[model samples]
Target: MEVFEKINYLISEKNLSKKEFADKFLSLNPRLRTTGEAPSYSSIYGYLSGRREIKIELIPYIAEALNVKEQELFNFDLEYSTEFNIRYSKDAREIIELLQYAPKNMIEHIKATLQKFKKSYEDGVKEPTSS
Candidate 1:
């Protein structure tokens, strides 16, 4: 049977055994396998085994149920640029949420730190101009 190693990785990272995860979903939504509104036990097993492709509709729901960002489900390559972008997206979201209630002093510190980091990055990439 085919298997996407990435799926297994994500499952493990979410601290869920395959059975536990599937059971949780089925438990949360009883109409799943019984009513054909969702995948059956075999189908979820197929996804875990890589014998089936995970449908796009389930991505967000699975991520939410698993308590992680959707990016965690599909991104297996840590070295890929997409990985960096996804992480940045998650981090930015978290920062924005936290900033909503941040004290003035903390907000100022964060802003100053970000500005310094941005300036340093720019300086590092600048080329010398000829007179």
Candidate 2:
């Protein structure tokens, strides 16, 4: 899968229309475009339709705007492909290293905690509990 395919998959998985996704992205990163706001519809359409490629320098901002890790922007296969030579940031690299050492049970526990935390936070609760 290429970057465009991955992005399309993510967009569909999230059940977001292009305009809604763009709006949410802008909400996350108000400084994404030179206008200090989200990209216009045409810009998004151009990128998604392959008329314009997503620039390397804008990858971080796009990932942040989408509330995803920068590495997630690339297709998983691309990450393993010899042709793809992107470098991870120090923090992201450390996280990848840590994941290698993490136990399955630990990863599951963290996932559960994160789910609970997200729910609680969205509900404006104080904290999440195991139960």
Candidate 3:
């Protein structure tokens, strides 16, 4: 989904009107443009209506007003796919979401840690239990 679509989806999910979002967005007091002024309500409304492109600089404030991480603005998968019929705990889900925005180096470290856990599990499985 495009950024605007994602924003609209989030707005609906949050049960907020476009006007309410615009007001909350301004309440955050984000300064942009050469004039160092916050965008006007009409400008924000234009962005929501897809009449104006959202500025890249406004993403942080927008995300904050939407009560989501900045990366969430670009994430199309608002709901997890049920194709696998797999379910995880809320904490696990949170970890997965956080991993989406984690730095590459951190991901590499996590991969190494997971490999170690996998190896340990495999080794334990290979060992016969004593009666």
Index of the highest-lDDT prediction: 3
Q: Which candidate number would show the highest TM-score if scored against the true structure?
A: 3
Q: How well does each candidate superpose onto the true structure, as a TM-score?
A: 0.49, 0.49, 0.59
Those runs of model 2 whose alpha carbons end farther than 4 Å from true positions after fitting are: 28-38, 78-131
> How far in Å is the alpha carbon of 111 misplaced in model 2?
20
Model 1 lDDT per residue over 26-126, tens place: 65563343355878889888877877887666666667667767776665445234525443544564677689899999999888877776676578844
Which residue pairs clash in candidate 3? Answer: none
Residue 102, model 3: lDDT of: 92
lDDT of 2 by residue, 1-131 (tens): 66766666566655778777666655655344445555666877777676777656567766765667888877465344454343433344457669878999998987887798789978987566766
lDDT of each: 0.65, 0.65, 0.79
- Candidate 3: tens digits of C-alpha lDDT, residues 50-77: 8899999999999999999899888655
Error of 1 at 127 (Å): 35
Model 1 residue runs over 4 Å out of place are 1-4, 30-36, 79-131
The reply for model 3, stretches above 4 Å from the true place, is 78-131
